[model samples]
Target: MIDEQTARERVVSAADRLFYARGVQAVGMDAVRSESGVSLKRIYALFPSKEDLIVAVLRHRTDRWNAGVTDAVDGAGTPRERLLAVFDFLAGWFREDDFRGCAFINVFGELGGGSDRIAEAVREQKESFRRQVADLVRAAGGPGHLAPQLVLLAEGAQTAAAISRDPDMAGHARAAADTLIRCALDDAGEPAAAA
Candidate 1:
C-alpha cells in the first residue's frame, strides 16, 4: 500500500497533467485514478473531492513556477537580465512539447466563477507572480509603477504564446519589457544599468 503523502503526490501529478492538457472540468476523478494508478476509493480518501485535488495541483504548479523562474533569474548576471529572465523562462516553457499556457489562468477561466476555493488558489498564484516581477523591477532600479506594466506584458505573452502556438511570443514580450525598463530608468534619472 502506498503511503498517504506518496499517494497524494501521485494523484496531484496526474491530475495536473490531465487538467492542464485538457480542461479541469473535462477530466473526471476516474481518469485521475486511472492516470495515477491509485484506486478511486484511495483517491477520495486523500482528496475528499475534485476541488480538493485541484487545489493540491495548483499548489504543485506554484512550486514549479517558483523554482523555474528562480533558476532562470539566478543564471543572469545583472538585475536587468534577471528581470528579462522571466520571459526567457517563459520561452523555454513555451517550447516544451506539453506547453499549454498558464495553468492557473486555465483553471481560473474554466471554474473561477463557480468555486471560491479555486479562485483563491488562482489568485494566490497570480499574486505571487506579480510579487516576483515587482521584486525584479526593484532590483533593476525601475520605479514601482513599472512592475504592473511589465507583468501585463508577460501575462499577455503567455496567453498569446499559448493561443498562437508560437514560442517567439516571449521574445516579443521581452523586447517590450526592455523598452519599458529603459524608459522607466530614464524617467527615474538613473544612469542606464548594465544588461
Candidate 2:
C-alpha cells in the first residue's frame, strides 16, 4: 500500500487536474477517487472535505507557479531580462494544451465569496506575486511606481490570453513591459539602466 504522503499527493494531483479542467464545484469526490485511483475512504481520510482538497490543490499549484517564475527569472542574464522573463514564462505556459489561465484567479472567481480559506489562499498568492514583481523592479533600477503597472500588464495578459485564445498576448504584453521599463528608467534619469 502507498504511504499516506504518496496517496495524498495522488489525490491532490488528480483533484487539481479535474478542478482546473472543470469548475471545482462540478467535480466531486467520486471523480477524484476515479482520477486518483485511490479509494473514496482513503481520499476522505486524507482530505476530510472537498474544501480541504481544494486548499491542498491550490497550495500545490502555487508551488508550481512560484517555481516556474523563479526558474525563468534565474535563467535570465540581467535584471531587466529577468523582469521580462516573467512574460516569456507566461507565453510558454499559454501554449500548453491544458492551459486554463491562472489557477488562483480561476478558483478565486469561482468560490471567493463563500470560502474564507480559499479566498485567503488566493490573496496570499496574489500578494506574493506583487512582491516578486516589486523585487524584480528594484533590481532593474525601475522607480517604485513601475511595479504595479507591470503587474497589471502581466495579470491582464493572462486573462486576455485565456479568454481570447491568443498565445500572442504574451508577446504583446512583453512589448508593453519593455516600453514601460524603458520609460520608467528614463523618467528616473537612468535610461541606460534598462539595458
Candidate 2 lDDT over 7-116, as tens digits, reads 99999999999999998999999999999999999999999989999999998988898999999999999888999999999999999999988888899999989899
Predicted candidate 1 versus true structure: per-residue lDDT over 137-160, tens digit per residue: 888778999999988998999999
| Clashing pairs for predicted structure model 2, backbone only | none
List the global CA lDDT of all models. Answer: 0.92, 0.92
The 10 consecutive residues of candidate 1 with the worst lDDT sum are 186-195
Question: How does model 1 fare in lDDT?
Answer: 0.92
TM-score of each: 0.97, 0.96
